[model samples]
Target: MANNPCIIIADDHPLFRSALCGTLQRELNEPQLIEAADFNSLQTAVEAHKTANLILLDLHMPGAEGFSALVFLTAHYAHIPVMVVSAMEEPDIIRRAMDHGACGFLPKSASIEDMTAALTAALAGNLWLPAGIDDTPAANEAELNIAESLARLTPQQFRVAAMVNQGLLNKQIAYELNVTEATIKAHMTEIFRKLGVHSRTQAVLAMAQLAINPNSTLEAFRSQALPLQ
Candidate 1:
């Protein structure tokens, strides 16, 4: 096979964007790649090249409008495939993107093997999913609690939580969410308080529990809590 495939990666964090590029460099042979740091940059990059084989999209870029960007891509470039790459392993977001024409989803915690598999599958016209999902819908009560919990958050806090769930560092989340790192720090404090948890891992776990079961309650989470670190 020729190195004819091209990829575009849209993310606000320069370091992560660069890291993704490196991943591609390691995994792909002579792959053509483009980088964008924001929504406008992504839009510009896409307009500049309509023939890209894949778009490695990050939904929570600063001012990127998340799913709205996915909609735009489907409307304008219906033929192109989009692989949502983010720390957001939230099943709802994953399912919703698939409903809207995304070709695949890659969680940030995805292993290198996972990335390679997803990319290869997407390139071969297959819709890819993480291991263990296995034909079952990712939903549940805990996911519902997360939804309710998020619904109760201020827009700023919600954005922060979303980024955190996506596995971004506070500084990176700050950049993508368009606030200072200090602001993100403050928001984390508030988010922990609101979610009744003290850490990002706990919040993500809570969301995962909720996603698998919408009826998930905080009490249920308490029973299964990891010992305090």
Candidate 2:
């Protein structure tokens, strides 16, 4: 069908990807599925097919690390909705995915029926979470403020910031992005201003604060939420 929707399935596991593709073929009406085994390929596919309807992203794919791909995509491609399809079923991980702007979280262990339902919900412009899981906002005010600051970064600034977080020098990032070191420096200046961080160390720490410690933060907040009359 020429009018069919386009979807990207980005997971490193071959069998898992095949299974997801098969499930989508059965559920969706002649969908155009693009498969990616790593974050680099995922980026290429998204760039090539700008009209993609949904992205099924695995959290641990090569080049993605943890939530780096999610953060980058959500920051850059806010128009395309993302649904995290990861084996990481930890509540904190799911919560963090949603907080980072995923429209849905589907565990790899989910049945075909459940997968179909979640995909449908996401395509219908609704948020989906595992059954019985609360969709409460996961991050506290301080953490959300950091996320908002990160979201404020332009696409190029976000890429440069991610490379910086990976300990890449300006020259290295410049070479990777095919731009001059001077351009990278200019982007860094804007990045620091948007993030309110004076130096690279502070900016990396700010991103880390948002990406790390969800479980501990949730536990602490839950403890505090307990009532004592």
Residues 1-118 of candidate 2 have per-residue lDDT tens digits of 3336799999999998998888888888889999999766888888998879999999876754367678778887888999999877978778888988999999999988898889
Where is model 2 poorest over a 10-residue stretch in terms of lDDT? Answer: 220-229
The parts of candidate 1 lying over 4 Å away from their true place are: 134-229
Q: Each model's TM-score, in the order given?
A: 0.58, 0.82
Find the candidate with the highest lDDT and give its number.
2
Q: How many clashes would you count in candidate 1?
A: 16
Candidate 1 lDDT, 39-133, residue by residue in tens: 66776788888988899888776542345456557657767899888888867668766755679889989999989999999888789987654
TM-score of candidate 2 on Cα atoms, chains taken together: 0.82
